[model samples]
Target: MSPLVADELAQWAQYIQSATGIYLDGSKGYLIETRFAPLLKEVGTTSFGELLRRTQVDTTGALRRKVVDAITTNETSFFRDNSPFELLQHKLIPDLIDTRNRSTGAVRPIPIRIWSAACSTGQEVYSIAMLFHELKVDLKRFDVRIFGTDISDRALAAASRGTFAKMEIDRGLPLDRLGRYFATDGQTYRVKDEIRAMATFRSINLLEPFTFPHKFDLVLCRNVAIYFTERDKARLFGSIARVMAPDGTLLIGSTETITGICPQFEPKRHVRSVFYSLKVNGS
Candidate 1:
């Protein structure tokens, strides 16, 4: 394939932002080249511009999906950062249950709905499921449903499989927890049925308008907004606020913030971690 020229890079950057809301400036020209090079060869395109054009005109959307899969970064692991899960295990889950018990009563099964946005390959979703088990949260007493969504179909497929290679299991997953939650299959491990049953996966574009039938008690949109532009970031969080329960909590990347971007959410701190809640008025 020929080199990706300035014009082609600009067009690709624009197209990527439009389709996936991931901003790619001129400096990221090499990224477009590096990520799309394989697709170029597979599609028999001689140049980056040709590949972009093919993707745009492909009616089946198969090529477009491939482009999305190739372009979007799926960097994730089981409990990627320790603090958020720690917060969930120590504060969020307990506090949420206490709040729900008051309204629904102790006998009724309290619903705990969670959304892990851009949940690449299901690690975060499974991590949360494992926490419920570790806490000995009675599944009969608490109806726990963890929803995981991402833009890449490839990523979602891997997530749905509930299987991981040895390297994947090594990152952030402890040995004791692994033995308890995963079934060994040669060098690979699969999440146990009990843990797998607690979560669901789907494909969703956060930049586009979306709605859910029910409001989530906790939503984790971590490490994804940095890819989007400021306007899109505001739009993204605004939409998230709508689908959140009145007393719901939102967790973003440790390095990211919604402070100036979205006024609907108010930050709350617990130990070393920070999470967001809908302001009383905002809710």
Candidate 2:
């Protein structure tokens, strides 16, 4: 891997940030050098400069997606943060059930939906499914749905399979849950059939045009939005708001909150952490 040429650097910078919301700052040179070196070699490109030119100039468009896919970071784990799930288990679900039961409407379970936007692998989606299962809650009554989407077809393809490497399974996932929900296969652990059946995976780009099939009871747009520009992030949240049911809760990453950036949500305390709840227009 030769050092990227000046024009190569600029083309890659603009191409990546425009296509994906990842803004490459100064240290990005090393990322390109280190992470994508093997990709260039695999493509039989002699230098980063040539690969960059092909991606920037290719009318074929295949090279462009491959480059973008290579650069996209897909780091995640099960129950990455535990507080929100604790709140969901102890407080939110019980209160929601009580509230719904009080209504003199249908004597049936309500539609419960969750959207994990940019759900990288199956871990987070499976984590939620495992959460419900731990509660010993029967899914026979409720219309439970979890929608996991990512821009990368490659990522979504892996996620939909519900398989994890031993390292991935060891990371943050509890032993008790693992024993119950997974089956060992050499170096890998596959999520049990029951958990895999609970969630649906699809390919979606936060930057491009797309629509949610239905309004959700909960939306977890988590750590993924930190990549977007302020304008893009605002637009992203606003579009998200269109599909968020007025009373449904949206869980963002602990580090990334809508405060100042997105004003549609009202801050509320749950499990000693701050979360944004859907707000009623002050009227």
Candidate 3:
């Protein structure tokens, strides 16, 4: 693979940022080449500049979609990081339920909506649903909804299918939970309809405007912000804050931070893990 010219690298950086808020620099030139090489060959282009030109002139936007999908990192596993789920199971869900129940006087079913931002292939969404099952929360008393959104159409399609390969199931998924929530067919496992029905998957770009129908009680934007520019990170979290309940919980990557990115969220640590909540003034 040849190195991308400085001009071509800058062009791609702008295209990627404009399309997905992902900032690519010279250091990532090899990544761009490796990810887009097949697409470039399939499109019969010999140069990155030619590929960019073709994508720009593509009226159907097919080339652009291919490029974006190829570039977006869809790396994830079921319960990829253990601490977050542990926190959710042992503390967050219980506390939230209690808070909501008290506010409503147990008069109506509690609504607990969660958004798995940059949710790749729906593992995290289903994982959250599985937790509810594990907790044996009464569905009649709670109207729970989980939404998994990602930038890749292919990833969303797989997520919507609710099927996972053996390796995918084995990674970060507990065997007991697997048997309880999934129906096995040979080596592959399919999430049971009950769990699948609790969640929805959509193709969403974090850089764009959000129009969710309801504000979320919990939002997980994990392990996905390292690719964004500082300016874009501020914009992304600002929009997220707007769609969050005043007391909603926000979870970013274990290594990621909103310290200087979004001021509305303040970090709270539970044991070894950390989560964020809306900062109340004068506290």
Candidate 4:
């Protein structure tokens, strides 16, 4: 395969941003090369520019999907970054339950909805489901629905399978929890049916327009936004704000803040975590 040149890099960067809202600058030429090398071979393209041209002209859109699958980062692990889950267990869940109870006293089958945006490979969704199981929350009394969405179809397909390799399970997943929540499938671990049934996965592009029939009580749009430009980041968060319940909690990457980016959300702190909630007035 021919090396990725400056012109090809610029073209790919623009195309990626237009299609997926992931901003890649001149520095990412190597990333484009490395990620697309295998793809070029599979597609029988001789160079990055050839692959780009094929993707553009492929009316079936299969190549475009492949490009998206290759370019989007799907790196994730079970309970990756411990603090957000901690916040969910210690503060967010309790607060949500209390608010629900106060509004509708002793309502049976209380509704709890969560959206894990960019939920790569389903680890985060299952992790949250496991946390709820560990908390001993009565599934019979809660209308719990955890929806996981990502732009990559490959990632969503893997997520829907709820199967993980041993190496993946070893990352941030404890042995005891693993035994309780997963069933042995030869060399891999499959999330038990009970845990698997609690979540659903779909393909969604956060940079594009979308709507849910119901608003989420907790929204986890973490880490993925760092790849977007400032304007796109604002657009993404602003869209997230509209789909969140009035008192819903938003957990971003530990290093991220929406302080000036989206003023509709105000920061709140727990023991070691920071979460956001909508201001008194809606955005």
For lDDT, the strongest prediction is: 1
In model 2, the worst 10-residue window by lDDT is: 98-107
The CA lDDT at 77 in model 1 is: 94
Task: Assess every candidate by TM-score.
Answer: 0.98, 0.91, 0.95, 0.97
> Which stretches of candidate 4 lie above 4 Å from their native place?
105-108
What lDDT tens digits, residue by residue, belong to model 2 across residues 79-155?
Answer: 88888778777876666555655667744666677888999886788898888788766677666788999877678
Task: Give per-residue CA lDDT, model 3, range 137-172, as digits (tens).
Answer: 888889999999998888898999999999999899
User: Against the correct fold, how does model 4 do in TM-score?
Assistant: 0.97
**Regions of model 1 farther than 4 Å from truth:** 104-107
Residues forming the 10-long window of minimal summed lDDT in candidate 1: 101-110
Clash totals for all candidate models: 0, 0, 0, 0
Of the candidates shown, which would achieve the greatest TM-score relative to the real structure?
1
Give the distance in Å from residue 122's predicted Cα in candidate 4 to where it truly belongs. Answer: 0.7
**Candidate 2 TM-score over all chains jointly:** 0.91
Can you write out model 1's per-residue Cα lDDT over 230-275, one digit (the tens) per residue? 9999999999999999999999999999999999999998889999
What are the lDDT figures for the candidates, one per model?
A: 0.93, 0.80, 0.88, 0.91
lDDT per residue as tens, model 4, 222-275:
889999999999999999999999889899998788889998899998888899
Kindly state the number of residue pairs that clash in model 3: 0
Off by over 4 Å in 2: 56-61, 101-109
